[model samples]
Every structure is written in C-alpha cells, then in structure tokens.
Target: MGVTEYSAKKLYAHLGFANGRDTMVAEGYRMDVLHVWGTHELSTADLLEWLGEFSPQSVEWIDDSSCTLRCNIIMINESTVLHVLHKLAEPFDRRVALTAMAAVISTMNTHNNGGDFERALRPPKLSPVEGTSDRLMPPCGRWFKSISSPERALCLYLRIAHKG
Candidate 1:
C-alpha cells in the first residue's frame, strides 16, 4: 500500500508512524485482508521493519512471507483507523476493503465497552509463584486424570477454546 508523503508526515507527527522506531504509543492501522497477491519480494527484515513502524501489539507469522499483525483498535482510535484504511485502500480490492471498514465498526463497539475489551484480549499471565503455570496441567492424559471431575471438565473446555 502507498502512503503519500503529506499523509506519511501527518501520521509520523501525530501517531508516531515512523520507518525506524519501535517506541510507538499507537500502531497506525490494522490490515484486515490476509493475502497479498502478485509477484513481489518482501524480505523478512523489511517486513519486521514495517511492523515496527506501525507497531502492532504483536505479529503472528503465518509463514515466512505472510503474517497477521493484530492491533487493538480501541487503543488507536478512529481517525488513525481511517488514515490506515486510506493507506490500505490502494492495495486491496473493494470487497477486501469493505471488511476493513466492518472491522472498524466492531472495534468501536469494543472500545465503547471500556476495560472489557482489553481484559478479554490480554493473554493469561503467569503469577509470581514459580511453576504455577504447570498447576493448570497440559491437555494430555496422565495429568488430565489427576484433576477433580469439575476441574477436569473445565480443563477440557479450556483445551478446546485454546485449540480454536
């Protein structure tokens, strides 16, 4: 996607969307479309640099060439979302572009809910207690057999949820 120099300067000044830094308070945008078509060489370092510039919360690598960068839109607000969408518009088809708009609506809804959105997305953190994570036990057998009936059922549900 192409960003005009003027637009790039605006993003850089207001939102910290820079080419060389990881110290960003907000990642400028989220690309809803997963696939990048046409023959092009996108190096790993270049991809990582792009990710750093935008500063998404985390980047999930689909493969060497493809990755899903997730940003909690609630953190960036609507104007930045629109700016990113404007930048993304050139690379995507109409259908794919529409999905990005739809995501904006969903993200706004989550934003309206205050802390709930952030809490739901935060990964489970290990407590100060050492080896505490192991207490939950893995999804496999022998350990599964050791838990009480209710805990076992809860563990199974968690295992399925994790799989999804």
Candidate 2:
C-alpha cells in the first residue's frame, strides 16, 4: 500500500495521535501517525544510538527533532521483535520494553494478514499465573531484569506517524 494509504488506516488507536504536529510543542508538519509512549530515561541522542545498533537498512530515521523522532522500522519476523525486545530490555525498564513490544506487535498485526504476535508471546507450556489457563503474558522477569531508579523518570513518547 502507498504511504498515504497506510497512514489513513487507524492501525493504532491505543497510541495517542496529535494531529498537525509531531511533538507536544513542535509547530511543523503533521507527523503524529503512530505514537508509542512509555516510561524511559533515554534522550533523543540515546534513542538514535540505540536504533543505530540495528541494521541500517532496517531502520531509517526520517526526522530527528529535539522532542520527536520519526523512523521507518522494518521488522521481518518474530526474531526481529525478540531482538528489539532484547535491546530494549538492556537499558530500559520492563514497562518500556512492554510498550515497545505492544507498538511493534500492533503495527505488524495491522499490516500483516494473520496474528504473528500471538505466537511470539505465547509460552511453550501452560501459563504459571493462577486462575489463568493460557494468558498472553510476556515473560518479563524471567526474560529480563526489572530495574528502577530513584530519580524522576521521563516519558519516551515515540511517534511513528510520519510516512516519509
């Protein structure tokens, strides 16, 4: 589908979109196509550095504003998602990882035919949570360590709304 056609579809309603602007205060083009928000302490530079770790062909930074970042991320399969999750877990908290996963999954599911995300997060055996037979719970604690800091946490609001 064309970029405009893809953007027309309401792929992610959960991720809030700010019409006519990318960031909260920025007064430029309308870039709020896909918004991913989570608690994080990383700045724009740090985020760009993290993105650079991935393959150059996979991630293309179209816009890198002071308060906003627009990139075209190409996730080929579940392995890509896992790699992203691993990278996110390295520096950020569980919440941040979860948010990124959700955004990636949602975006993938929206464009793809079947639900690839279901298989990605599904546990091999039965869920360990009580009163739940087969809950879709991400293996957070087991997969990665949950670390929190005493200092104030910043919200990492990443909007993937722009197409170009």
Residue-level lDDT tens digits of model 1 in 1-164: 45565764444343224551123322423333222111024443433354344343433444332333331211123233334434432221234445787797578757677467656656798555774444343323111111221211221110000101
Q: Tens digits of per-residue lDDT for model 2 on 36-150?
A: 2332344444544554554322333443321222334444432333344333432333577778988987788777753676676677885477634222233232122213211
Extract clashing residue pairs from model 1.
none
Candidate 1 — which residues are off by over 4 angstroms? 1-44, 51-53, 71-82, 94-164
C-alpha lDDT of all candidate models, in order = 0.33, 0.37
Clashes of 1: 0
Q: What is the C-alpha RMSD of each candidate to the true structure, in Å?
A: 19.4, 16.2
Q: In model 2, where do residues sit more than 4 Å from their true spots?
A: 1-35, 39-45, 56-78, 90-164
